[model samples]
Target: MTEFAPDAGFRKNRKLKDALLQHKALSKDGLSERLFSLLFSGLVYPQIWEDPDVDMEAMELQPHHRIVTIGSGGCNMLAYLSRHPSSIDVVDLNPHHVALNRLKLAAFRLLPVHADLVRFFATPKLSSNSAAFDRFIAPELDVSTAAYWNGRDLYGRRRITVFNRNIYETGLLGRFIGAAHLLARLHGVRLQRITEARTLREQRRFFEEEIAPIFDRPVVRWLLSRKSSLFGLGIPPQQYDELASLAGGGSITQVLKQRLEKLACHFPLQDNYFAWQAFARRYPDAGEGPLPTYLRPEHYPAIRANAGRVTVHHASFTELLAAEPAASRDRYVLLDAQDWMTDEQLNALWGEISRTARPGARVIFRTAAEKSIIEGRLSPALRAQWHYDEERSQALNVRDRSAIYGGFHIYGKAA
Candidate 1:
């Protein structure tokens, strides 16, 4: 797999009409299993979580804890595995994501060696080594997952084609980015050109000169103001309100600029490889370490050791919590999953969490609002046993990364 760069030339207009139709029709729910099953569906890429280091910092996890988290894209599951916890239960509602996680775990277990796995996932272009997949990864996948990868997309292209090719523009967030890119192109701005800058100084220049100018455009501003518009990026409605409030007018462009500004300016461009991926579409190099260390060769021993401690489930958090033994889990990572729920749903989820959480257990989650989602909502009995670290959580909030989010919270079960 060649490291996909920002300047990777896109095949212009291969299926322009279809892309437009899907883009227009991708409502709030967007891209169901039926759609994914029919689309260029291969085992999607393994990497999914954002800022593992930041997440760990926020979590303050201990070695002895058993954790539960919403699996989402599975990046965090692998990352937490690196911490060597007693156990982790990852549950998700998305079947595609569940399959992706299972495939990743299988790859970790069956790959010939770590470097082989690293090269398989981190190489610049995947087509360069069909042998890697055919020989190791493909064989390891379960039958259903294998079938998924064999499926075709809107363009009638097989999902496996993404490996030999770059499909950075495919996920929910990716599609939103594609839409934003097209809109930028229409307004005579080229995001790809700016995103390709090699240096921090160059990145700043691009953001200020090319990217910044687009925010002032009337069409961009109007579209950005709508709460439902960012569903493509997976931002829930309540979160959109919080993010909009952060921008002073809820301008998506403004919020994006502010967040990208941090990625571009706060950390060294070399160290902040995540910035490179967001802007440049690739890692700096292997010497910088595999894109995700838990997926890398060096940590495979730890991952393998901890892998057995995990159980992956496709279910709602509320449902999962209800079935778990009382006072069993020590750590819970909700990961902004609450934003998708209604008030009644939130109450139900927390009620079970309160019952299942052991004394001294810690729960961390992000929300679409700046305040604790449970503060006024949880039943008095449930809320009373959980101690909210308000001041610390506020201090830990990274405005730039969370500019699109409402808040990050940490709570401890009162002993």
Candidate 2:
């Protein structure tokens, strides 16, 4: 377990920092260690990478289901609330993430209406969001979480002031994407032009002419080759190994190019806000672009109605599950966190998952590789208790608009 400084945000995650260091591909490299330290020092995800639409289709969350998910950007968990789940437990190793989730819940409950919430999140340049926070949501947050957003940065400005800017461009991933845009400019490519393409052919043309060549640049490939360089993507060192193996002849740059292309060219720009955020550093529109389900206007009422159902905490999956009674949880959204675990960690996690999972409960996760990490890793007894939904996983992976992962996997507890 990590000890967090109540007002320190993510920089206080001692355990997570130690874990990532141990798993680092180049553990002895002082440079990698330092980069990992800095990367984990703040919120890594302003938007989650997993596609909740595909996840929702796979889980088929009933009104009775109890959902547990890794609270990345807290988007998908809020998205799940629209299904009217009985309860949702969202945990994160990063305190900043837990604070972010709590802040979202508070905003949903405190804001006058969905429009105010949208303006708070979607319209980043508005000063009204900060005012809304002070007037409505501030009184509702826990002491620690409120302190996080209220604390001033080195620049002597309130951290919450980011809401007055483009809040989506406010995290490690956001800065990474912004850096990518700068790099593209250096290569004489306007990455945003891909968003202008009206058809798949035009998208592909933009990629080949603008994006693909950026990947070929010497500096780009050099940076991509370093595992530390990818920490901004929320990829840990161990997952870097998996991505390397799957990158077609050990070229991780090639793998990133393929994934980026999938995000940019395989889906229509109007429909894939993931692409828009990646290139443009903000959604295509303030309230009209393809937004996350939780951020959309129609889903806002349901989210507010059920926002109280979510309980955010800072803990590991196994630790959280072990605290619950057997057959207590029904749906699991692990994201790609398992890729950072050891074989022993994998077995232990599955062991706890199998124990806590209700009969017919579904466990869904993404892998940096196209295969689930369960095979040949867990005891046969433990593995037999769950059945893999291979066909459905494959189908859903294709439908995943995020298109950032190699595979989407689902496992169901045998009835």
Candidate 3:
């Protein structure tokens, strides 16, 4: 099979495609649409924001379930694989993401030992990562995946060297977090101190002392007002509005402060890798902080055993779902990609999801707002097929270790 180039992920529904190609005479909506396209053109997420642990809890992954999920940064699929699902159909419209998912699946398959793999991904500064890639992962990659990672940037450094650095600090999302740290420093705050907090009280105290004051700064508030400033967070203009609405219009900074407090103080430093990555800019040393489920040695063998079960596709979720057999898939993880879709897109998506999902199939997704966008948007016929677990969703949202999103929702297909 021929490989898709890194630049090939732009193909989408005609409406979405047209939105991407909006001309200079564009109106407010047109400008917002085009900005969304530009943000997705490269690697948006170095690490995924939707917490997989919470996701697995909502989906209740079973060995018999055939899953389909958006392959963002490929972390969730890898996390899901630890459950030994019967199969996982991973789809993404971003070819870089496609390549990323491919690289991870290939690494789990080709790399000889768990420790070597850990050193390559977790050790941060390990120079031998490129060697590990060349020796174990490169040959397994398709032409496109190999080309993407090996390609050089303007500075002439190879893209593969991203692994040699703190890989978490290397993508669009990473740089956003890095900028946040820079802003905090300008306000004389050290975010990394939260990682040293030995108790929840300490974590709360550090946030009140160091992180909260920075949010009240004029520069930070001004920056938050610009949609383009948040392109690094993988948030589009539409999603930005949803978040602002959640904050009741004029309080984005306060909303962010509350969310960050949840990230820092609500979850333990030892188990909230999202917090570690945000505050410390790196996951903790082994046994110190929570590693993503797939990275832990205990789950390595199950992930490896099940890694081969994944089938990757470079297509939109709706496109792939429309092509699948009816009632064939049992678990759907939409991530927050739906937050970017139009009502037409949402109908098209859920229509196919409703068809492809088996009775009792569970769909879990996160949203920028506290409520799901699915209710009024999905047609009655399509919407009626699923039972929204509102009580559980509200409960899980509070428990989510990755506190970046405002809502965590679960919809179960009626049995």
Candidate 4:
């Protein structure tokens, strides 16, 4: 099977470089940034980590609304279609993600049935997936997108072969979870044990007895201290600092443990697919546990019917928004992209968002730390155009099934 060369044209991507490169080339921080950029240059998120249910609730998505969002892993974009939004413009700096988003859209449109789409995306080790992609998905793809899947890696196999294996286990986030599982196993802790708990009580017991102890290990603490160790989580150095700050002068491992505990205990395993991916590696077998909204059999019809409403772009969110007319878009989903931006970038992003926002337009994003990162960052005038719903944002943050992010924020364009 072909492995993706994640950094095929990484150096030439100025936007990515601008977002990631912050320190001198020979500096310690600089190397970590470069390394993360390289890994991120390929497929980082096989599945987006943010919970779309929480996102939909926060944004109050409507059928007449036009949505613009950062297209990470593309699941949420499809998930949003359940609300029947008029259109979704998805932008990303990584071409691999753009290609993946397009591939998912094509799969939804052309696959013969819901089960066929499931087999192609969710089933692992299915040898016929590549054949299905070739026959159904490839012919309809635009030239560049077709070239992306047809393109070969260092090994002499097409990129589409990733479908035949576990697509969830192939990207940077997948590898990170895989490594975490391995590390847990090495310490005689099976993280998957948490998934076996049928009740929240059992979940907490499993976390306390089995998973929590691993954080106290000297090696585990040392590993957590290194910013490079988290690159697989798609966390750049800037975001890592925010996560560390959340530790509040305590061990970063404690923060990780708390987040993991929430993931294990806050939601029932049967209802949270994010927990399944974290512990079980693949999504639950059909009808056994929850899947992302886009992958649920019931949501399939709606997503397929509305798949054409999405347009995928290989550009930054701010750049894409900059091209739109004023007061044109009604919803924005930034994911956690802002956690990586500089103050100047944040101002530029809000400037465009404020300009393009329709009346009552809502914006939702996540943060690495438990507070809104935009406070005092956006220029005062730009900030005044929006109202931050502090109580609602905090309420929703606890409800985010992903449990990886510290804050889930909601802002509304001031009427």
Candidate 5:
């Protein structure tokens, strides 16, 4: 069992530093990078933004497959268990995420009923949540994980109390959404109005009238121009550059507007929890709308039965792959971590991924721009080992309910 620890010394995390500190200290970009690292060292996502349904489809997960993925909010890994993967290895650099993943896994194992699980994770501000954690979840957690929940924040509130309140509105991304809501309110726009739409046309109407014009505001445009402004979205400076380039030298505000439009209008609110989180700041009430796959009652039995197969690690994806035997893993879900990697880091990551991937293994990832990041960056020999499924990638990219990513890519190792 890997013992989790508090994130008090995240500065000492060399892998995280190497990934974020690309510019010189005191430099404009460097300062932004440092600040993002500080914010990210804490919980970034209360629930991950990527669409696990699309990911599972792209990977073609099977019962015999051994999967390795970046465990952002831990939801995707739990969702993957619904497919009955042989096992899953979840890696992340943030201790908070590591602790959260462990807590979810423990909850699945010990929580008495599906409704209990829903109350603990889905419903917000329920005072019984912390008590449920103590009675059911805590005994199943490792010592360090229990310590993490028991530990108080700077405000002196126990970390577990977030469950008793609104966990969705508590993380960096959560606070980012809250700030967006505040900005909308200042402009006389109620962001939550989009959630009331009953149809796609109604959704589009709400977005055009209530949401799209915010990007045109002088203050909003100016703020969007700064790379640091998107740090709350977990987008690093390099990824911001990629997104800006997508506008063909135009204002990034336009690019952001287009993406936000997709998020708000592309999918129906009843089906997209991502939209609910962005606008409403919480999941829909049971039977009110769809929940994440892992949170749904139908999937709970499968997830709980297979929960033990997941092993959480506080490390980088490449670092974890390096320690595994060659050709051992059959599926890889990179999320958007590659957007933060440099050419050299990309090569190192692919080198290990190529080495550790079993024959016909599939790898899936998302990008900030409408193209694969590895196009010309990966070394030829390593790139030659995998075949990019361009058509399916594009199809999946369009189907992705998250709608935040510009591209969704899948690569299959040569058989």
Candidate 6:
């Protein structure tokens, strides 16, 4: 992990430097890592990956296609498994996410029955549900992942036990939210009420009555103007700048709150798994069970059979593609990773992607900027080989989350 001093030229932009300097100096509060660890540590948690629904549609995944995806928190990867693709390779820059994926895979492999697995993930207060870890899941985990849970936290709490106790709040993003909740409290705003609305109407009512008021506050507006404040949400300097640029100036908070309101007010609490994670920090109790397929009871056999096809690595996307045989994969999911890359990185990644494209292969990615990153960067010779489907890509995006991203693109090798 690279440790960036708050005073350092964090990125190429002067605005970002000013933004970081404006925020409070980095503190150890609840973070697992001290200063250096954050700079050098694996990404703190899984990113908000592109909508799984969007990814499935854009890929037009068939039983024959091999899929490669950045395994953020592993939710979409598990979601993809439900479709039963021929093979799925989930890679991540964070060892923690990789470990999380491995644990999910092991759960699918060893859970004795679907209902048992469902109870394990969907049950309220998982650790208190004693039958879960010892009876059904623990024996399945590999040693490395098992060790992860056994580790100690800053509080010296057994981290493995936190899974049973706090699986819902274990990621970098989760920790960020915890801190945000504290920060919001310090600001004299409350987020707890936002989660209590029982219906979409109720949700919207609450947003208007209880949440929207914060958007107009001077403090909220000030925080929105600074890029460093968003670092707590795991957004890097460049992503913060791009997101700020999207809404122009300090209005970004209003833009985000509006979208979050959509997430809260439009989707049913029962159907919106992302919202469930955000608000309640747990899955709904429907018999259909927790959202991800790897968390599902019935999918284990197939997931285990397919798990071997995955090889988790702590490498850049470009580096992984370089090591692969040409034409080795049929689908690529870049998620929002391009937003974090430089022009040279994007070109090199695209270069290898072009070389590795099988006939009709498709590459998918989301951008923080509204336009596709490849607009004029790729050589015409390379660009000509792949077809960009703008309309279809636009249609795949879910409204609430799509509002946060500039573009969702799919490039296919033309037949």
**Candidate 3 residue 213 C-alpha distance from true site, Å:** 1.1
CA displacement after TM-score superposition, residue 203 of candidate 6 (Å):
2.3
Worst 10 residues of 4 by lDDT: 1-10
TM-score of 2: 0.94
1-415 per-residue lDDT for model 6 (tens digits): 2111111111233322222222245533223223323532433554344567678878888878888888767767877776778877777665566666776666666766666656655555566434456566567676666666555554566554554565556555666667666666676656666556667788788768766776778977887776556665566666666777768744578667856676667776655666666655666566422465455556566665665656666455677788889988899999877776666666788888888878889999887766787878777777888899988877765543324566788888987
Pairs with steric clashes in candidate 2? none
TM-score of candidate 1 relative to the true fold: 0.80
lDDT of 5 at 391: 98
Instruction: Look at candidate 5 and tell me the lDDT of residue 142.
Output: 89
- The TM-scores of all predictions, comma-separated, are 0.80, 0.94, 0.94, 0.97, 0.97, 0.82
lDDT of 4 by residue, 266-374 (tens): 9998899999999989888866697788988889889999999999988998999889899899999999998888898899999999999999999999998899999
Write the residue-wise lDDT of candidate 2 on 368-415 in tens digits. 889987778888989999899899899899889999999999998887
lDDT per residue as tens, model 5, 189-287? 999878779999999999998888888899999898888788888888888989989988657888888888998889988899989889998898755
Model 3 quality (TM-score): 0.94
Alpha carbon lDDT at 370, candidate 4: 90
Task: Please report, in order, the local distance difference test score of every candidate based on alpha carbons.
Answer: 0.64, 0.82, 0.82, 0.88, 0.88, 0.64
Report clash pairs, candidate 4.
none
Off by over 4 Å in 1: 1-49, 128-130, 185-205, 245-253, 287-290, 399-406
- Tell me the tens digit of each residue's lDDT in model 1 across 251-282: 66677656656665555554554554555555
For candidate 4, the TM-score is 0.97
Clashes of each: 16, 0, 0, 0, 0, 9
Candidate 2 — which residues are off by over 4 angstroms?
1-11, 23-34, 286-288
Candidate 6 lDDT for residue 286: 62
Model 3 spans with C-alpha error above 4 angstroms: 1-25
